[model samples]
Target: MLTALNNPRPAMLAVFMLLGGSVAAAASPTITVSWRDKPPYHYLDNGVPKGFLLERTQAIFAAAGIATRLAPEPQKRIWANFSHGATNYCSFSWYRLPEREAVGQYTLPISIDPPHSVLVSGAALARVKTHATLAALLADQELTLGVVDGVSYGPELDAMIAHSANQMMRRTVDTTSMMRMLSVGRASIMLVDREDWEYVHRHEPILQSTTRLDFPDMPPGLKRYIVCSRDISPLVMDKINQAITATGGAVRSSHGTEEERKAHQRP
Candidate 1:
């Protein structure tokens, strides 16, 4: 029961309502940016939205003369926001998906994350240290992974999980739960961004146990795109990309490496 309070995921529609007025009313052509409560990435600060991407990009968008508002939503609602009849809605950041691309538009990356790492209990790290790729890691039937429901772990990891035996243990909880599960040795694995790893360590020191294994088959980092509803024009995405680039963000190029391996891409 205590875990419920610590890891609450209130309904997305209810959360968006707490923003005082229609997100559309905040700014003309308001880019209603939706985000999950993933700390170090996106989370609420005193009922106002603030986190790495929201705090960093919102100000930049404002400086670029683009109006913005924040909405906290569950992953499903965030996807729905891009479906038909949606307004100028957009996600704060995401690894673009084919389904999302089919329904809306993706801008050049607005944030960058080091290649996702396999977080684990200390004992689990020793077991997986020699494992280079996700496929190799999952070969051990004794191991299981914790996943955030609906989250994309880039193309390579996602594909690997899909094809692997049913070894994944998914939860609707946020990043905190991923860490909590690792601490208690829930499943021995949690895939997360390095930034996410650092963020959890900073705030949950008393509960933190940071042990990570890299997936050498994947790209060196994840590129975050702002997926906008169909109502947003390419010109708007171009302007958004311009603002993003000014803040050290850019689209990922071909993955360069000195080693030969299966290619797990970002798009």
Candidate 2:
């Protein structure tokens, strides 16, 4: 007859289904994954989210059997969310900074960025080229260095820039705007990410008048990881790390054309 107490399985199943949908739905907790607007990496395209890193992140969560809601937020808001210990919140593709460690737990590397290069205006190229190494160029107090406020040029460069004697002009702007500033000679030079340089160079004619110089003193590319608030569970982080191992972290070709992007997708 399978009375209520004798056979609680059916009742439990019904309650589970009623509460959520199925066992899977109840077991899988959904988290909000946030990212800043850094195109060809992670950004909004005409209101729809797009980016190789975003796609790769989606794939990692799916492979880990986790549920995620993609959220595009400003850089400041993203950090603020982590600082306040927002439950089940995560941000993608950030450098594993020492100061940031206090706010969030980092998963295994999610992406790797190529080393930074110097973007010099035509008026500054000759002076910039005179220096044999990045150190020498940064030490030049005569040159004004344009930096994006609150951004890291990776650990090595960040340290160098902090101690550099050069004149500084810092702004809170995107790479495109920074490139424009360089074109107008607002600053003599700026450190640029290789991927950002490629994307901006193709779209901005101003780059044609500028130069991208790589230096021997430049550090190797930096590895980026998915950082989550303290409230996110260890189980979830383990799954993410396993997924990162299964799929070689998300560094894909950043130079794909729009047609190619439309044709290709990760399986």
Query: What TM-score would each prediction reach against the true structure?
Result: 0.75, 0.84
| Clash count, predicted structure 1 | 0
Best by TM-score: 2
Writing each residue's lDDT as its tens digit, candidate 2 over 24-61 gives 64577689999998877888878999888888999998
Task: Tell me the alpha-carbon RMSD of every candidate.
Answer: 15.3, 7.1
* Model 1 lDDT per residue over 55-122, tens place: 76686676556777777898888776676557888886788778778987887777666677667776
Q: State residue 213's C-alpha deviation in candidate 1, in Å.
A: 2.6
Q: Alpha carbon lDDT of residue 15, candidate 2?
A: 95
Quote the positional error of residue 216 for candidate 2 in Å.
0.6
Tell me how candidate 2 scores on lDDT: 0.83
Clashing pairs in 1: none
Task: Find the candidate with the highest lDDT and give its number.
Answer: 2
